[model samples]
Target: MAGVLTGVVGALLTLLLHGAQHVVFGAGGHSFAQEVRLASPPRRLIGMTVAGAVIGLGWWQLRVRMRVIRVRDALGDPPVRLPLRSTTLDAIAQIIAVGAGASLGREGAPRQVAAAVAEVLCARLGLDDRHRRLLLGAAAGAGLAAVYNAPVAGVLFAAEVVLGTLDYIAVCAAALMSCIAVVVAWPVVGRDAVYHLGAHATAPNVWVWVVLAGPVCTVAGIGFNRLMEAARRGGPSRAIHLLPLRITAAMAAVGLVAMTLPGVTGNGKSVLEALVGRGGLPAGVLFALLVAKPLLTAACLRGGLTGGLITPSMATGGALGALVALGLGHDQGGLSMVVCAMVGAAAMLATTQHAPIMAGAFMLEVSQAPPTLWLPVALSVAGAWATPRLATGLKQL
Candidate 1:
């Protein structure tokens, strides 16, 4: 009962923080995207290069002079925490990256931010063992909810991925926090849904396509998961001696490539939006993007990457699936043919995250794409199955 109470409180906090983030992103996204577009290609490239350099330089100097633990490392040890300065800075930098087109998600920022804030509270409150971790989880959930404006999704993610289980107090606190965050963010972000889906086609449900899509998604999901692991940073676990140079160099490379395929850069929301509306891409262009996005993201985190895998991978998978469908020659997927490519994208994303509900919800929000997409559903399921198996096999190998 006590745990349940705390959980509810945590949930509310999660909701509140997530809501706050959504407002921030919504108010700023359009202008930010436009700014990127206005900048000369060279200028955009330079901006990316310079930002990466600064980030890298900071890393190096900080590590050499004092211990600098990124939020990613902070999370490695359970019951771990980071200073608010580091956490907030990461949130700001990452959002700027996404705002400026970094092909990553803004959602991760709140998680780190919330975690650090919760730790501060825990220390001041002198929370006990269970309470301390619970606070962290609740804070994370709150942050996610604030960004997504979906308390349930945040709750599930925190319980499933972060805390690894549900508890009474956590559920309560999270619920409360989620509510608070949303309430606070309402004015700034507005009550509009993230991605508006206009009108959806109910379904003459294509079983044949649905069945095939599942397997295809499975393959895609497995491929993506492997890519992430392969891209995992290679270096000492603790702070490296020369962190800045490494990150700056990686950023420079990513910037050069991103100029060619902006789709491959940033949190990928804009690209996905453009694709959904335009209903197709030059296969060659998309193919290049799919390859570049993952590889660049891989490079970005080589040793000290701080962000979430779910969003970037989802966008990349979608692009790959879309490209595949494009090759199949399906145009808008009109009433009959439907947009097979977009279907593939959504299905592939669903598979990789193993969060079909979240994937479905997110895609629905982001693309305003058709619903009751049976084929896409099947594919996402297939990908989820394959991703774990592949990961397991890779581990064995």
Candidate 2:
């Protein structure tokens, strides 16, 4: 029942996101990135500026009145209750912000709303703390599964990240909820993989690049995490009276950048699609995005905005991987850009979240990659997961 309700909520949120995007950017039948690119400079600037102002005001009011309990915090030992009104409002604000060109992932909104639904259901049924925690984690993962149609990744996310355990019982519950949510969401969200990677047989030399690029991606992922942390810590106070103005100013700066590089606007999905697609951006442009996307994301975080970093992190890794492939001259033959991008994405995701199995599963499920690519992907994930620890050990030595 919780999964069903969460699935419905996820579908509704997905519709609202698309509606908001269409209304804000006049996207019509086009993707957000294309619309932004086609829009005039002034439109891009004003759209983002207005979005910032609106979210700034909405979040300011919400924060001033009620304490917003994050999804993770709500799964505490005693099981913190997620206030329905405040949490839903926060989720809506996040969706609208992302829809209007905020450089943040849309995944967080669904997760919050789904978890809130689970919390409310658990309370009414008088579920115990243990059951409640398990349900909450499962619902959060279900939300992700609904949005992305990746049940395996959702189960792994619940087990590894939310519940912080792979206990058999918890894993079973998560898997059931995730599968249910995905099925319920199929009508609205479609069953297609989020990013399409055409057929490409895994080549022998691809393993070589994966091995060479793993440590590099690991370092980049760690650095990206650190940068986001710094941004959050250094951002403006949420309680400040002039928060709307500050956020507006920061968003306006983002708008200025978007005037030329519109791909930097949304949650990095477009960037990822371009990276793995044929005739991808030039090496110089990929490198520019490798630097620009994270900085833009960090800026949004610093502007007191809240959203997920998952897609942005993946996109960054993809760009880095493409660059590495180019550097090694793998683009000439024996390696496809798609494989490199996926490997880099998995490696980076594993490093950032510190969950190699989940990361690998996520990339595979979301891309619908062939089974043969698993070997290189797993190798990359293992290398990425170990690199940071090795670096720390070396530092200690």
Scored by TM-score, the top model is 2
- Model 2 lDDT tens row, 12-99: 9888888877766786545666777777888889988987898899888887887888898878747468888899998998888888
Whole-model Cα lDDT of every candidate shown, in order: 0.58, 0.83
In the range 262-329, model 1's lDDT, one tens digit per residue, is 56656665455545544446667777877777777777667454566666776676566566555544
In terms of lDDT, the best-performing candidate is 2
Cα-based RMSD of candidate 2: 2.0
User: RMSDs, each prediction?
Assistant: 5.9, 2.0
Error of 2 at 192 (Å): 0.6
Pairs in clash, predicted candidate 2: none
Error of 2 at 187 (Å): 1.3
Residue 151 accuracy (lDDT) in model 2:
95
Tell me how many clashing residue pairs each candidate has. Answer: 72, 0
